[model samples]
Target: MPQVKGSKQYHMVVVPHRPVRRALIIVLLLVAAGAAVAASYYWGYHQGMTQQADAVAERDRLREEVSVLTRESEELRQQVANLRLGSEVDQQASDEMRKEVIKLEEQIAALEEDITFYRGLMAPGDNNTGLTIGALNVIGTDIPREYEYKLVVQQLATDHQVLSGYLNFNVVGRRGEQTETIPLHELSSQVDNEDIRLRFRYFQNIEGRLTLPEGFEPERIELMAQSTGSDRKTVEKKFGWLVQEL
Candidate 1:
């Protein structure tokens, strides 16, 4: 052989061709099935966790609402109790006020009695006949259209024998267009047989009631006394119409 610029070497090889694509496809299908099972398991676990979190949050929210409602109920109860206490206190105060009023009225009545006693001791009567009308109190009773009067008579000189006397009570008033005189015996139902007589040496108290007629109005009163001794003594007094009733 002539010298060639390049020498060529040849080697013989044998390869067997079979259907390996179907086997590869079967392997790929098994791998894909395993991956799908793992992904499904992960998704189910995540969904369960999310549902549990939502349930816990709802439970907490309901508990908070229950706590707030409980607090409000307690507050309402406290307010009601305070109102009841305040009402009790107010009632007690009102009762105390009523008691004070009653006590004050009693005190005022006692003061008035004391004033009358002192006045009788201080200023003597104007009658120079050794006899005096000390006090005249007109009081009202519980009976309707009825009045009571008190006359206190005092003797300055005990020198006389018990100054025996009787009182003549006369009421001077106006009727229609004319002047009228009313007698004490006519206005009272208890004036009979020496009932208006006084026989005390120092003093005498005369109390009696006077009931008016249907429409008779009284204005002034004249109280006259007649005493018998060696010389008959007479005294007259005038009093304004003053009476009280309950």
Candidate 2:
């Protein structure tokens, strides 16, 4: 060591070797990027949950609409069935009414016929008091060309005496463009005798069954009655051939 006279004093200070401020800035940027990514993920999850809820609601609404339509269709079917049944019942009722009306008409016609017959028996419209023809009727039978005939004779006198007579009848018709007349005895299957005798006080009904020949179209009937005993008289009558089928 060397000795110096009158020397000045010196101070010592330390400086940092690493860059700490730049490292702090880099760490702050990394934290900001991570926050942005977390925010985006949360938003997407919320949107997906809301869309699922909306789809579920739409499905329920569609199911309700389908159920309503099904109920309406069932009601319409029931109404149609009821209408058809009512129509059938109405048709049956109408048919029955028509049948009843027809039956009533037939009964009325029969009653009218009976009234006419009784009136004729009570009053005869002829001047001859000895013997007279009241009515004549022809009825058709089931057998072909066969018919039943009825002749009614009445007495117009008030004495009510017994009358005896014999009747002769003939059927006048056309056969193949030729005039033909058939006697009652020849045409009648039930009456074999030529003389039809009658004995009655007020009225007498002579009935017989007859059959016509083939191709014989009858037009009229002629009858002649002759009284026997004290009241000797002769009566002639003509009647048109009209057959009532039974």
Candidate 3:
């Protein structure tokens, strides 16, 4: 082998694919970051939607509960109103009853008063007996010449009837002259003479006519009556006679 120029060893410059690798790596990292961001955004949106739904459901539930409570409150209020109305009606009825009771009591009291008055009226032994003398007339000088007298006798006892007895009347003149004793039965011929019996609590009227004496003038008259009872009760009366000229 002839000695040729020394063969030089060729060292080729080898450039590595660093840029492509770096670019690929950067692209991958960017994709991964983008995916991660997208995933995070989606998760956040879903969480928001879920929270919204939950809030809506909670609001709906709250609204339902409020409606139920409102209905129950209305029912309770209605019940209270009804009870109050019932109470008022009962009070009104009680007031009416009280008024009626008062009216009835008044009526009963009035009736009782009327009954008492009637009872008093129906009581016995009411003394309603008296006597009366008619006007006396004179002939000329207004002096009494003739006189008419009426005597009324009433039985005081309402239990039994009384038989008529003799009625004695004495007329004392101004001159102290006395009249005669007259029988009551002989004075009235119209009456039944069979012992004039008067019913219980009845009045009997007896009339008599008398002529005065010519010399004496009558001024006053006195009357006395005696009942034919077992005790013989007597009644006396005095009256002034009016003397008028006829």
**Which candidate leads the pack in TM-score?**
2
lDDT of 2 by residue, 95-155 (tens): 6555655555555455455544444334445664668787799999999999999888866
lDDT rank order: 2, 1, 3
* TM-score per candidate: 0.47, 0.53, 0.33
RMSD of each: 46.6, 47.9, 55.0
Kindly report which residue stretches of model 1 are placed more than 4 angstroms away from their true locations once superposed: 1-129, 158-161, 193-195
lDDT of candidate 3 over 48-136, digit per residue (tens): 88867765664465446555655554554555456556657887555655565556555555544444332322333356332212222
Error of 1 at 22 (Å): 99
Better of 2 and 3 by lDDT: 2
Root mean square deviation (Cα) for candidate 3: 55.0
Candidate 2: minimum summed lDDT over ten consecutive residues — where? 115-124
| Cα error of candidate 3 at position 127, Å | 7.5
Note the residue pairs that clash in candidate 2. Answer: none
Candidate 3, overall lDDT? 0.51
**Candidate 1 residue pairs that clash:** 140-244, 140-245
